[model samples]
Target chain A: MGHLSAPNDIEDLLRTLSPQVLGALVRRFDDFDICEDAVQEALLAAATQWPREGVPANPRGWLTVVASRRRTEMWRSESARRRREEAAFASAPADIELGAVLDDSLELLLLCCHPSLTPVSQVALTLRAVGGLTTAEIARALLVPEATVAQRISRAKQRIKASGARFRLPPEAERSECLAAVLHVLYLVFNEGSTASSGATLHRVDLIAEAIRLMRQLHDRLPEDGEVSGLLALMLLTDARRPARVSDDGALVPLAEQDRGLWDAQTIAEGAALITHTLATAPVGPYQLQAALAAVHDEAPRAEDTDWQQILGLYELVRTIAPGPMVTLNRIVAVAMVRGPDAGLRELATAERDPALTGNHRVDAVRAHLLEMSGDLPAARDHYRLAAQRTLSIPEQRYLAARATRLAPDDHA
Target chain B: MKYLILIYSNPQSREIWNSFSRDQRAAGLRDYAALHESMVASGELIVSEALADPSLAKRVTSHEGQALVTDGPYAEVKEYLAGFFLLECPSMERAIEQAARIPEAAFGLVEVRAIMALDGWDI
Candidate 1:
């Protein structure tokens, strides 16, 4: 990966490799920001020295050594009394196993996404340290002001420091619980890529790819975990339809209007195999069940051929396990498709009354669609406007506006 | 290499400070001590200290060729500048490393800036 060394280029390289390098350094230093800073200094040194030295044989290992040495030197120069004290405590020679440290970076990813932190903070830091995203990139993906993302990252780092969180993988006993957090983070990442809550384009393929890569890493490490397999299936099945989700103008193409031939057959096949394998082993988890439902949809050659009953059943299971407002909203759509629009409208009416579902644009959008299907053009138009007003994503807003436009003529006085 | 790490806090208002119990304060102090020890061991930290509450402090600023004095901080904010650390590091990277180690940064802010070099200024 040798190239012309410029300041911007150095920054780009640091952003790309910071997660792996900083994670390894944290294990060595047991301090997140210190490790990060040392790595930054090492990179700066590299930027100044590497061009002259023509890059090291193993750049990562070389950077780690340089950063670790810098830390020791800085410590020694700071205080004589503390240096003597540390010298007394540091009786044993330090081990510098770069390979093992690099391998432990995966564990750091899990820790970064731990449930202790808020989801926003978890996503921000995970993107920075695990996905190797710049703070600006994370800010853009999150649709937050760049300064906000920077503050969140700083606060998250400070909290991790104050809590004395270690740099090792969760113990065997806590692996299941810890793995759930990791999965949740990856799922959020993939979802952001799949639909993209807010962006000029409806999808961020890079984020989706990065998430798939991380999920594959998880599956490799924990082969017996059915949920891991389930998650992989869910992502693949959902991603299989990416090609058919948009038109050439980048406008969203509803599933019913999409050409089935455009779907990625390879992804769909892999997803179906994973889902089937997962189902055979144990009672399928929510992700696995969702993947199964998507598989049913994918199996159908046309929209009319979809097994709505099976999808509704899976939704029922998903709602029972992970009963969220979004799941309920999805369940309503399935009900409307299987039974009638009236039945879906009834389900949505109940969800709309729930305080937790209030202000949720997806619920409003689903309600509008059901109302439109049921021939209540006026009510559907109202809900469509509501959905458009509530949604922050440009793509979603455009979809709602388009739906409203399509229903406008019938609603006109 | 010379850096200024300012810690922001409000001393007059007990509301924010009182939110934490005695044990929490002790824990904070312990962490601060540990960080101080680490900074001292690292040999980059020059001098660090906490202020005696902003209520008891005064600000002197020059305005329009005249000296202006204020009874309280320059601005009325929820948090005030509570302490600082003057450090000499080899680079901005080291300065940030030390900044992150500050105890106040866990709950408050710690801004790190490099000191401007003067032609004939003596340390």
Candidate 2:
């Protein structure tokens, strides 16, 4: 497990309550900007005031009152500036009581992903609004500038307001597209967590945990959606093997070399059941295909017994829908195992010619392994050197360099 | 959100593109057209246009209070603006996805920028 900075109880309490408090405000006022700001202020207030005073008997009530008042004040000041004196939200919410507000995290996530925003904005807004991440936290997670994330979120909110997007879920006819957007963001978070784009650590487990938690919550709300279950299954199956994915020294372990006994059986079973159920419904979506692929790997008790042929077929399907270098690389590896090294080399040569994989470390790593397998130690050494040069992770660099060094004693390949 | 998709063509990409077979060029155009049609169907495309050849270009400048115009296809950069698309998308991902689907993006580059505020012109 990656190092998880265990959030203190206070931050945990606030994070848990954020969606509910913000949901209530949005439901009552329907002003995303004002309500969001009000709720943020209220959460900040709770962060300070909650510790000073004993926990309130009615925490939601306290938050509702504070956020509502803040929103009302904002509405009043804006109307005054315009000199319109709008009747709506003119008075403070002194008498308004905290009603039962549905957990609107899923709804809020969908709202943040409204089609008018770009993918970057959707991810930023979702992390801020539903994930309750500060802009700085989001910036760190995305490996981008704080200012850029701030601008994207601000612009997304403006676009949402201009489009008059609804806070509630869309109609059934439009639900599929909206759901895809929601799943895409979650998947992105999962990918980032599984393999961080840069820096020392190979994983960002916090994001993985966050995404899984959110997906679990979503599954609880909409259990019937096969794709939802499929996505959750995919994430779980992938996360299940993470413990065995790294060595004691933190170097990445290839799937074939990983200790199979260390894989989490409970998670694998849960994910397998979900994938089986989802696939029974004849769903052939990206998540389902990926989950099926994971299942094929997890079902094998030993690396030698892995269902490479099944995985190869699944990869072909995945490539048809989502053609990319990484997927092709995996497929190439599978082909190498099933057909032979030469067959894999033929496919990999085509992939090497692809512009998408130019200078990509994974591609070079695969090339080195295939060349080594084909009894071409000199070429393998050269490719390993290239692989070491291409990667950012310290562990990956060491691993590739070790391979290069093990192959040849002299500097010349 | 509204995005400006800028299509850029560099001399290297231009050379590679010009070396394509006629059928390959036609296939590239077909892909671009298909991508545009899909965006139109999804209501994500607000406007898109391919710029005329830069060889017929004119440059205009303003000094103090006078309008100055110069005629020539002259630029100092290896990359030149080839075309653009103004799209009202739901997210940056969609805009980028659309931009990447542009045929020239295979050899050149496509950059997507979100407009800050719509104070001028009409949506």
Off by over 4 Å in 1: A1-20, A43-55, A73-81, A84-94, A143-146, A195-205, A358-364, A376-379, A410-413, B1-123
Listed per model in order, the count of residue pairs whose N, CA or C atoms clash below 3 Å is 10, 12
The C-alpha TM-scores of every prediction are: 0.67, 0.70
Best by lDDT: 2
Tens-digit lDDT string for candidate 2 (A1-413) = 12223237667767777887887778777789788888889888877777766557777778888898888887778778544345554544765535556567777888888888877778778778887777777777655546666777777888888999877878999998999999998887776677652344333337788789888988988888888998999999989998887677656676777899999999999999999988897557889888999899888999899999999999999999878878899899889988989999999988888887876778889989988988999999999999878664555677778889999977754
For model 2, residues B1-123, the per-residue Cα lDDT tens digits are 578999988888788789999998998788888987776545455568887777667888889989798874555556778888887666678788888878767775889887542111000
Evaluated on chain B only, what are the TM-scores of all the candidate structures, in order? 0.73, 0.82
Model 2 earns a TM-score of 0.70
Q: Residue B116, candidate 1: how far off, in angstroms? A: 43
